[model samples]
Target chain A: MSIPRNWRTRQQRYSLKAEVCNTCNKHIFPPRDVCPHCAAEKQSWTNLSGQGEVFSYTTMYNAPAGFEEYAPYTMALVKLAEGPMVTAQLTDVDAQDVKIGMPVEMVTRKLSQEGEEGQILYGYKFRPMLREAA
Target chain B: MRDVVIIGVGQTRVEEHWGKSLRHMAHDAVMAAMKDAGIETADALYVGNMLSGELGGQEHVGALVADFIGLRGIEAMKVEAACASGAAALRVGMFAVASGIHDVVMVCGVEKMTDAVGDEVTSGLATAADQEYEVSQGISFVGLNALLMRRYMHQFDVKHEHFAGFAVNAHKNGANNPNAMFQSPIKAETYLRASMIADPINLMDSSPVCDGAACVILAPADGYRARAKAHILASAVATDSLAIHDRRDPLTLDAVALSSQKAYAQARITPTDVDLFEVHDAFTIMAALSLEAAGFAPRGRGVCMAVDNEIGIEGRLPISTMGGLKSRGHPVGATGVYQIVEVVAQLTGQAGKNQVQGARIGMAQNIGGSGATVITHILGGV
Candidate 1:
């Protein structure tokens, strides 16, 4: 649960991100150091809007002790607008409201803490777009 | 690769083995298969194990099982692919024999999961998924499966009752199995009323983590005999991205579909040709995915098939007559070997009560992680 001191600087993004192979052009989430398709490490970083549709989602009642406060939370596989799918928690909607193809956006929130004082870690979660356009 | 045949199979009942040591339980399971095949010693051994990091605080289980099984001087190694570790061990043993480096090999899968508490077990199993990306966000396996179940329900117009039917059917068959961890039959209505884990998934839809062991002995094709019981027609293994986020569609398991396709091709058989299936049902939603991946039903059609009673014993393809991981008990390492043993039982006409009539051809699908590793095997009567 402890985060490295320079994690924010070294790591690309706290949220899920990936690289699409320049050749085969397949989406690789969490962006691999090398492309598994064409065996090329030559790739670029791209910021995802964190908005996508639910590829699939699940609700879990049985969770770890620290997670009991959020019991029965919905976990979803969100297919990002950029292409690669990301696994994250769905928020601001009931589990029943979350379904395949439902639009969602990412929001940063406190996931869990390791110990005392400044030990809290923040991560991204997806929330369904409930309000319609004006 | 050379032709390989399964000459021996053995398993111990899955439940509270608090009275016995893990190694002792493993030895007993291995010994049964050795005696069944009349094999006194093994040239090489592979053990499928998971969660030793947090469970027993031990690693290197391969040498441990080998030493206790009286194969001290033999080459030994452990194979892991999450829950599919058992099937992965079987694949390694198959390769060991097929490569001509060894004429005979032994594979055993054992898991002592009950050693840890519920929270610890959940955390341990959570490592199977992407730790940094998914788990850090508080996503448990049940939540992941629930999302999949919810999506499948919404997309295919499947009802919560359909899932209950799957659970009820498994329990009915599991009751006939003396070795199943939970042998009592459950009604679909009761299953629906059971405490829910996610909105649609309930406690009944989940597989309990139990402790058990299963073993199998493999030899070259020339070692087969008429009374050998069953022959290994094909064993195919495939792997996909380890992280669930990496998959194109969470509902579709490309690794499983690909491995099953290769296995069926190698065996020259289709899903229709198989008499029964012992596919992994680590979760209730898994049964539906397995059916689709194995080509018994089209994508998104498994729920309908279940509702129509197509996967039942009297239907076109009977599945998990041994209760599956859902009811049979998921011993992690032992699960894949258990599937093989069940197929062997069905093919040899030894499966009583719940057995499919004149069962001859059988298929087993065992997966690791969230479908990162999948191994499919087709076995037939002699």
Candidate 2:
């Protein structure tokens, strides 16, 4: 990935920054200027709680380009407490133990390194929340 | 608007054509279609392709294929909607003929996926999903479907075995199709024993990656009334959120429902009127979802239709009559036109062994992405 492009969206990648529409009162992850639901332009940036349940998930045995090292990793659609769903990799948990409705918390982690000389990208990944904490 | 009729259809066997370049495959199909139509040239050519740039390092395939076929200077362009590119191009061709702008329009869908390695093709297919959120998370295309399949099983309390019949029936019908990539039949037991690509999504559930090209000639029904194979009863395209998570319900495909409903309205018919349906069975889950979204079955019960053997050619609401994307091989963009070509074959009584008995009306639904872009076309035999 290009350095400029990766740097531009660092806030969302690092902090789980999302947008909330004033009109629709709906939250959108990976912030967009316009609200997809209400078509409203009045939106505010907010940091998500980074805590949610797994809506669905999969263990990706076949990794895509730049993700070969993370083969057999689990990825999930984590439904945040604020109501928006975010797709993220599941860390600190075995794929076999991952199930729907499993509580998870987001944490910043290295996503991938572009090329040998390219930038090392870091993004938020979800890990299973401790049962006692819930 | 003038009514458009499909006069001719041609396609290459869905297989790994390592010797054929994209232009060569397109030329073969276009020439075959033109020969079938008994025409020398067409007013316009619309080529539907997904990844010529990513996989083949080539773009502007419309002009390239048109010139290669010796039909240069006519309005030629490429139409892309991920995997639904073929049907999207066909939709454009339909509009061209209906508007009286082009007398004869050629729509070809071609893809050369086998030229690239497996991981490269996998990465290319992942472009169909959300690049920023979904693919950035290192999920493959099959990984996305695996999540869906797992969720569907949990949500509906369905078993993995329920989805086996779709592949079995597809392979069974494919055995009779000369152009299908996998002509050998598969059993449900084989589906169960197949190695897992992703957890819950076995090797048997996925369509093979291959190269293919399918072409169709559309003209005004006024002149070719007697010889036309099928009339374009209805053509509709609809879209939903590109990312599956954005949908109101992940299990429901709003685009498929909307497109099929729109097509049904335009054709003045209901889903039951369709004798055969060529659905995009890129995955077995996709087949079930498409069936549910297109009104073939209730929500969360699409797999039941497969389990009950209702999708067979001899059964009610025959689906994937000529092998579908499963056994015919999904060459991405080419799959949509292949569906249309197979539908024409059934309509014209050209489908030798895979013909659906008394097929008068047929529907073909080509889906792009998880369920984002859906193009539905309803055809009627003359």
All candidates' TM-scores? 0.92, 0.98
lDDT string for model 2 (B44-112, tens) is 999999999999899999999999999879999999999999999999999999999988999999999
TM-score of chain A of 2: 0.93
Clash pairs of candidate 1? A57-B147, A58-B146, A58-B147
User: Model 2 — interface RMS deviation?
Assistant: 1.0
Score candidate 1 by TM-score against the native.
0.92
What lDDT tens digits, residue by residue, belong to model 2 across residues A25-57?
A: 899887777888888899887888889999999
- Top DockQ hit: 2
Interface DockQ per candidate: 0.61, 0.81
Relative to the unseen true structure, what is the C-alpha lDDT of residue B81 in candidate 1, on a scale of 0 to 100? 83
lDDT (Cα, tens digit) per residue for candidate 1, span B1-382: 8878888888899887887767987898899999998879989989988876668897988888888877898999888888888888998998888899998788998899888888888888877877777777787777667767877888888887877767877888889899899999898778878888766678888888889999988888875664366888989998887777766577788998999999999999877899998978888888898788778788998776664257677777888888888788888878999999899989888889978998888999998877888999999888
In candidate 1, stretches whose alpha carbon ends up further than 4 angstroms from where it belongs are A5-28, A35-41, A92-102, A128-134, B224-227, B307-309
Lowest-scoring 10 consecutive residues by lDDT in candidate 2 chain A? Answer: A125-134
Query: Chain A TM-scores, all candidates?
Result: 0.79, 0.93
In lDDT terms, how accurate is model 2? 0.91
